[model samples]
Target: MVKVSFSSALAQKEVKKDAESLLPGEKDPEVGVPLRQPSRAWCWCMCLGLALMLSGVVVGGAYLYRYYIVEEGRVFVCGVKYREEDYIIREEEEVQLPSHFQLRKLEESIRILEREQVALINVPVPEFQDSDPADIVHDFHRRLTAYLDLSLNKCYVIPLNTSVVMLPTDLVQLLDNIRMGTYLPQSYLIHEEMVVTEQLQHVEQLGYFIHSLCQGKDTYRLQRRDRILGMQKREALNCHKIRHFESNVVVETLICEP
Candidate 1:
């Protein structure tokens, strides 16, 4: 509802001039061509242009998101200046590990094993009279089994002398008892106790069996074949004697792939 105004002087002047021009009775020249309805094609072209512009914006935004925003972290890392001694791994190489290194590693390994052996041997008798001494035996059996299994399967070579062996069925069953966290039948347990006074003797035999497998070899090398060497955590004493153990039995064995 805006009111448009024309200049008063210009309007008056134009009216006077027109009046003077029209006195001769000459018809006024045609003012202008009348406009017709716009063609449908023009409307279609405008819509098409708008659609194209919208599509271009969407595509550009996606490109910016992926290569600029998403990849910004990797780009920043690549642009960083690094020191020469930063251990940038560009290529793979096989470096022969030194004998001294092997010695040091084995010494550390043996120290840990010895500590574990001592811990197993000196298991404090449970304060409760109902507790079983055979639990100590179970714990030792598990460790020895791990050691044997590593020697048998994993090539975890140590500086200590060892002998390779194909384990007998009886020994295998005993090892399984440790893995399954199971006990032998009462008759079998009684028979074994009668045969050997100390469960520690069984451990010694297992160790001897493992030692014999080394065939007097002084040095052995372990090449990692698997992505993981496996994990090592001691199992808590199994009082439940549940046949179906809740989790996968984790055994810490000498470095050998079984």
Candidate 2:
């Protein structure tokens, strides 16, 4: 009304509005919105999780390397000293030590042996008639030789016949004897003995028979002639008790009590 300019009046209204907005009791433009800060708990948890994952990977890698990469490639050569106790009947003798080679090499040797028709047999004592022990042993050797010759074409057979006589008691004595140097060069003797002893126990059961002896019968007695006849029949019927086989030449020991 006092000749004031319109532009000046508009500017004054805008300033008044801005002042009102900044007043203490006025609503702020950003009211009711929460500000987010980085969480310390979440950061710590993520770091711990990553550390645990890294530790597990390291342990698993070590185990794999030890078992597969290192151990599987290693070769162990054992010196087998055959003691008299090693055989149930024969005296002590030393068998040649096996050539030391990696698992792959040994496997290759075995495959070669098979391809060349090698005869590898695990001999178990067959039940014999009422004859001398020496005769039984001799007969076994003869039969084995013939069987092996017939079975293989071009071959090298390792005779483990001495292993047939190994008894549980003999095994205990062997360990002690080897440790005490009853045999010379006690370096790897004990270790070899233990391996062989364990291996022998894994073979088939020993052969034996039960014979019943009866004294003077009074009334119900079968004559000696009849008894002898019956025995012959039984023997003839059970003659096929012995078991044998042939294949690519691998003998796995089966564990059982004697």
Candidate 3:
């Protein structure tokens, strides 16, 4: 009888334990420990990895931006010793020539056209070992153009009527492609011979661009032999030449003085 009573009490205790577990406040001991929340250090580590990846992406993007601008020639920066304003030309002149002096068309790749009474000449930067890459640019019909000397950090300007030309559409596209390293055109070499008919006495009257060019040198006004021969005969003159290159054209300007 005692054994039966003890068994009945043990079964009752088991039933009570199961009922306690079924209640919301109690957990069954057999279910094992509840899962723990992530540690603070682990969460921080994950955040750091994500932050590093984001920073890497930003840095890579910046590097690519700089590379394209430089390689594509969108931004041209000169040396620290150079100033931008010193090379600017504020003065310009326009001299009318007689219609009899006709400029011959050089070739298919080059054309000398007059737009709004301005003469478009195919002139380029004088070649020098120290000379940096430069570009010529102007707004069409602006009558003013600039020769940007990247090495010297100079922007020389001349009036269109004075044999300076604005950037043509074809040449502009070609230069862009060259800068981007996409295409290269065959370069043509040409020469222009000019005789110095008159020494420049009034340097002040000359444009700032030309004045800068003639600085420290005896400069003279140049004229073609064909034009001078038609007008009058002249003696042989002392001569010097400047070799220049731009885009696909190389020009040798021979300047002579009596």
- The lDDT leader among the candidates is 3
Please, what are the lDDT tens digits per residue for candidate 1 over residues 1-258?
Answer: 999999999999999998988797664577555679999999999999999999999999998975455423210000111111212222364434334431100000110122122111111223333222211111232233212222122111222211211122333334344444333221100000001011121223334333333333322333222222342223232221101000111111223222
Best-to-worst ranking by TM-score: 3, 2, 1
* Deviation of model 1 at 206, angstroms: 50
Q: How accurate is candidate 2 locally (lDDT)?
A: 0.28
Instruction: Kindly report which residue stretches of model 2 are placed more than 4 angstroms away from their true locations once superposed.
Output: 1-5, 8-38, 74-258
TM-score of each: 0.21, 0.23, 0.35
lDDT per model vs. reference: 0.29, 0.28, 0.44
lDDT of 3 by residue, 1-258 (tens): 455335888899999988887899676668887789999999999999999999999999887864443223222111111111212222363434345543321211122222322222323333334223444433345544334344444344433323423245544454446554432333334555666566556554554334444354554555665566653345566555443433344444445556
**Residues forming the 10-long window of minimal summed lDDT in candidate 1:** 188-197
TM-score of 2: 0.23
Q: Which structure is stronger by TM-score: 1 or 2?
A: 2
